[model samples]
Every structure is written in structure tokens, then in C-alpha cells.
Target: MNTIWLGFSQKLLKVDRYIKKSFTYQAIEKTFAIILPFIIIGSLSMALSSSVFSKQGFFNQIYDISSWLPYEDVIKKVLEIINTVTMNFIAIMTAFLSAKYITRSFKKDEQIAGFTGAIGMLILNYNLASFTSDSNQETFLMQDLGIRGIFISLILGVFVGYIFKWFSPRNKQEKVDQYTFISRGVGGLLPLAIVLGILIGLTLLASMINQMGVNGLFYSLFRLTEIKSKHLIITILFLAFFNSILSGVGISGPLGIMQGGLDDTSIVSNLSYSLKHGTSFGVPFPISIHTIYDSFGSFGGTGMTMSLIIAILVASKNKNSRKIAKFSIIPSLVNINFPLMFGLPIILNPILMIPFIISPLVSMIIGYFFIYFKWMPPAVYNLPRTTPAPLMAFLGTNGHWSALFVSGIVLVVTVLIYIPFVKLNNQAALIDGGDLNEK
Candidate 1:
């Protein structure tokens, strides 16, 4: 088993190196690094707005902060705006930064390319029929301009960058003059036209489909899949796996999409049953994405990454890894792992990918069995997304101690699963002559 593991780790390291050296990966890494501050701010804003200031928030319910705190309503409104701008507009920011980095990678006009990419993203989601309306206001598909549209944003960004690289004239002279600026702007015109033309065409098609009453085709497909699945367990596991993979590649997954202010039918049913029975025990749809994956598998955010942070703190000797883990603890506790995701650089990490995907699946399986055997009640309450992992199941089950205990157990198991992989990452760093402490 040891020999087999060592061989697998070596092959994984090779793949990691190849991926890390790729232009796309490098561009993405840089993009994430640049936008990380915004992500952190957005995360904190969401946590505060949803979990601290809101009337239904865990802390607000306990403390009744609005009654005592001065200008509480104003503060909540401010935070909400901050959260919306930073989080809801993340895809546009990502497109701008990704295009800039990718263009830089090719020694092209990054500024113009970046702006072009942002314009393209906006055009892709723009409602063309808004032009025919009485109101002068232009409408955009706000949903696709946020986290839900990041994958599309990334694609458009990269495509725009490449088009600029291929079509725009390369900067050959070292000296900068007014003529240089003119030449750069002229050079980018072709790429900009091509990108916007393509984007407009796609938008027109989408608008036509919407006119035909085929709205939300992307969301409808997933909803249909959920409605049609015969085996609940298999469906849950498949979503967990699929979500993990998409998240690993830095795209928002189905889980994220489904959970965006839209309650799952199973979750709604379970919640209704629990409310009527005054207990989560024997609730309808006991084993569900909410009860299992969200409750157990999402500890420390996507991939049970909170466990990865703990594992790194316990087993890794790298100073950078440990420092990042320490910095990430607060955010991870509230189910925000963006710090660790980009800081530990888990987005494209190969070694961590193993546990990053596996840990969640294992946790979900444990959660399923725990609910199946009546060891704990199923989750029923709709808690804030920023709620702490251990408390999620407990609160969701209406203060079930057994649910909390089971969540704790799942957390420990996920940490154990990540320990060896963390050690392997340290070893790989050493082999590459990289200073783990400095990295």
C-alpha cells in the first residue's frame, strides 16, 4: 500500500508541475491573487449582513441587536450594498483581471484587452429586448454577472486575451510615445470587434430563446435532473462530486447555483415535516443535499476545506502553509475558505485535490448513514450560509445535540484524510527546491 501510494503521489506531482507551468493556470493564479482582497471583503460583508445583522440571523435572534444597537438598520443596509457590489459583481471583476493577466502573459495590450473582456461579459448577459422597452434603462442578466457566471466569465476573459494576442500588433519598441498609444489602440480594435460581435450573437440567441418562453435553460436542466433522479443517495453523491470538481477548477458548481436563495424541494419538504412534527427525526427526505452535503460535507466551505486547514496546521512544516491556515481559520469557521483556497493556492493544486474531493464525499456518506440509522435528526432549518459548520446541523435539526456530535466526528475524519496529503505537499515543495517557509 505504501509503495502504491508513493507511485501515485509521484505521478500526481508531475501533473501538478505541468499544470502550474501552463499559461492559463498562471493567468488564473494571478487573477485570483489580485482579486483576493475583494473576495475577503465580500465574504466578511456577507457574514455580517446575513449572520449578524439580519433579524433572522443566529446572533441577531439571540441578542436582538436591532433593538439595542444604534442605527442597526442603516448598518445592515450599508453591508448589503457592499456585499452586493463585491460578491454579486465578482464575475465582472474576474473577467477584467483574468483578461489583463492573460494578455500580460502574451506581452499584448493588457489594459485594452481587459476592458474588452469586461465589455464582452456585460454584452453576453445584456438583454437586447430592453432596447425595445418604454423605459430607457438597459437590463442585464444580473445572475450571470455574479458567481454563477464565473466559469463563463473566465472563458470569455481568456478568449478575449488570446484574440488580442493573435490579432493585435505586438509592442516592439522600448520607448513610449503618443504614436505608441495610437498604435496600441488601433491594434486592439480588431480583437475588440471580434469578441463583441460573438458575444452579441450569443446574447441575441439567448434572447430569442427567452422570448419563446425557454428561460433559464441552464438552471432548468439541473432542476429536471433533481426531479428525475431515482436514487437519492446517488444523486446527492454525484452532485457532491460534481460540485467538488467544479470548485477545484475555480468554477461555481451546481451546489452553489442551487443554494442561491432557492430552497431545494427536498429541503422544503423536510423543513415542513420537522415544523409539523416538532422534531427532525423521521422527516421526509432524511438523507438529502441539505442534510448531508451542506451539513457535513461543506464544513470549512467547499470540499470540507476547513479540515484541510486543520490538517495543514497539524502535519505540515511549511511556514507559509501554517500562516495561511492561521489566517484562514476565522473565515473557514463561517464556511468561507477563499483565503485558504487562493493562499494555500488550492484552486489548481494537485496533491490537495485528492482530499479536496474525497473528504466531502466521505463526510456526506457518514452524514447519510447517521441520519439513516436515526443516530441524529436530519437538518430542517434554513440557516445563513455563513453559519459555522458544526452548528449548522445542530441548528438545522432544531438544536439536536446528536447532530452536532456527528458533525464533529465528520470534521475529524476529514482532517485525518487530509493529513497525509498535506505531508506529501510539503515533500513535493522540498523536491522542487522551493522554500516552503517562503512560499
Candidate 2:
């Protein structure tokens, strides 16, 4: 078993190196790196908004701040705007940065490529009906321009960047003069036109088909998981697997696709039933995706990343890994793991992939059994996504001690599962002679 594990780790390391060398992967990494600060700030704002400011927030539930806090409404509004620009527009920013980096990789006019990528994203999300209607109002589909659209944004950005690379001249090595600047601008015009034309054509085609665009189609596929069925566990596992894989590739999962648990039918029904029955003990969906995955599996964000952080801090000797884990702790406590995802870069790291995918599924299964056997009630309250992980099940079940205990047990099990993977990652780094403290 040891020999087999070692061989698999070696093969995984090779795959990791190969992926890191790819231009597209490099572009995605740099895009995430560049946008990480915004993600952190946005996460902080979201955490505060959900936990402190909102009437339904965790803190507000504990004690109503609005009754006496000065300028609470104004502060809440400011935070909302901040969250809107930083989080709601993340995909647009991703498009710009991704195209910039990809164009830079090909020595093309990166600034123009970045603009083109952003414009292309906008074009793809453009709704003709919004403009054509007589309401004298324009509506931008936030779903297509926000976290939900990241996968499409990255694809579009890469496409735009490559178009520039194919059509535009390589950047000059020498110092740029006015003539050179004009020449470069003129050279990019063709690529710019080509990319924008393609995007425009696609938009028009989507409109002609009476479709919202690629992202709309993508989410439509996701909505298929919402079908009610007797095979509840199968559906939950499918979602868990799909969400894990998408998140592994740096795309926002379905849970992150819609914040606040507002649109999820199962969550709504569970909450409604619990409220009506005055207890979560026998809610209709006692083992739903929300009751299991969101309540327990998603501790410290997707894949129960808090476990990863704990594993790193406890088992990793790599300075960089330890540093990242420390930095990620606070955010992870609030169920925000973007810093760790991009910084430790679980996105493309094959070494962590197994545990990253497995830990959450394991936790979800444990949670399912706990609720199934009546060891705890299902989490039925609609708490903020930013609520601390261990407390989520407890609060959602309206102070169920057994729910909290189950959550704690799940966290410990996931941490154990991740520890071995974290050690394997450290071993891989040592084998590669990589500087553990580098950057």
C-alpha cells in the first residue's frame, strides 16, 4: 500500500507540473492571483453584511443591532454596494484579467485584449429584451456576470486573448516611440475587430434563438439537478461530485452560484416545514443537499476547506503552506475559502485533489446518517453562507445540540482525511527541490 501510494503521488506530481506549464493554466492562475485581493475584500464585506448588518444575520439573531445602532441602514447600504461591485462583478474582472495574462503570454497587445475580453463578456450577457422593452429601464443579468458565469468568462477570455495573439503583431522588444505606439495600436485593430465581431455574432445568434446565452444554457443544465425524486441521496451525491469537480477547476460551484439559499427548492421546503412544525426533526427533506452538504460538507466553504487549513497548519512543514493556512484561517472561520483556494491553489494542484473532493462527500454522508437515524434534526433555518461551520447546523436546527455535535464529528473526520493529502503535497514539493519558502 505504501509503494502504491508513493507511485500514485509521483504520477500526480508529474501531471501537476504539466498542467502548470500550460499557457491556459498559467493564465487562470495569474488571473486568480491578480483578483485575489478583491475576492478577499468582497468576502469580508459579505461576511460582515450577512453576520452583522442584515436583520436576518447571525449577530442580529443573537441581538438586534438595528434598534439602537446609529446609521445602521446607511452602513448596510454601503456594504451592499461594495459587495455588489466586488463579488457580483467578479466574473467581469476575471474576464479582463484572464485575457490580459493570456495576451501577455503570447506577447500581444494585452491592454486591448483585456478590454476586448471585458467587452465580450458584457456582450455575451447582453439582453436585447431589456433594451427593447418600453419600461424605460435596462436590466443586466447579474447571474451571467457574477460568480455563476466564471466558467464562461474564463473561456471567453481565453478565446479573446488567442484571437489577439493570432491576428496582432508580437510586442516590440525595443523602447517604444510615438510611431511604435501608433503602429501597435493600429496592428491590434484587426484582432479587436475580429474578436468583438465574433462575440457580437454569438450574441445575435443567442437572441435569434430566444436564449439568454452560454451562461444561461450552462445554468439551465444545473437546474436539472433540482428535479424532485425518490433517489434523494443519489441526487445529492451527484451534485456533490459535480460541484467538487467544477470548484477544482476554479469555477464557482452551484452552491456558490446562488447565494443566501434563496432559490433552492429543497432548502425552502425544509425551512418551511421546520417552521410550520416548530422543529426540524421531521422536515420533509431530512437528508437534502442543504441539510447535509451545505450544513456540514461545506464547512469553511466548499469541500470543507477548514479541514484542509487545519491539516496544513498541523502537518505541513512547508513555510509557504503554513503561511497560507494561517492567512486563510480567519476567512475560513467565516466560511470563505477563496484565499486558500487561489493561494494554496487547490484549483489545479493534483496532490490535494483527492482529499479536496473526498472530504466533503464523506462529511455529507456522515451528516446524512446523523439526520437519518434521528441523531440530529436536519438544518432547516436559512442562515447566511458566511456563518461559522460548526455553528451552522446548530443555528439552522434552532439550537440543536446534537446537530452541533454531528457537525463537530464531521469536521474531525474530514481533517483526518485531509492530513494525509497535505503530507503527500509536502513530500511532493520536497521531491521537486522546490523552495518551500518561495513567495
lDDT value, residue 151 of candidate 2: 78
State the lDDT at 392 in candidate 1: 89
Q: Which 10 consecutive residues of model 1 have the lowest summed lDDT?
A: 211-220
Candidate 1 per-residue lDDT, tens place, 1-439, comes to 9999989988988887788778887787777776666776777777777767888776777677777988878889999898788878878888898898888778787888899988887887776657787787458767677766766778878898889888886567622243466686788889889888887877777777663111244544554444325877787788888778878777655676655433467777888888898988988688776777788888878899899988998889999789778877767777877777766678778888899999999988988888889988888888866678878899898888998898889989999999999998887667765522211
RMSD values, in order shown: 3.7, 3.7
> TM-score of the candidate numbered 1?
0.87
lDDT of 2 by residue, 1-439 (tens): 9899778877887887787778898788778777777776776777777777887776766677778788887888888888788878888888998898888778777778898899888888877778678885445666678767777888988998889878886556632243376797898799989987988888878777656676776665655455344677766666777788878877766654433343367777888887788998877768776777778888888888999999898888999789778877767777778777877778878878889889888988888888888988988887765578878889889999998888889888999999988987887667655532212
Best by TM-score: 1
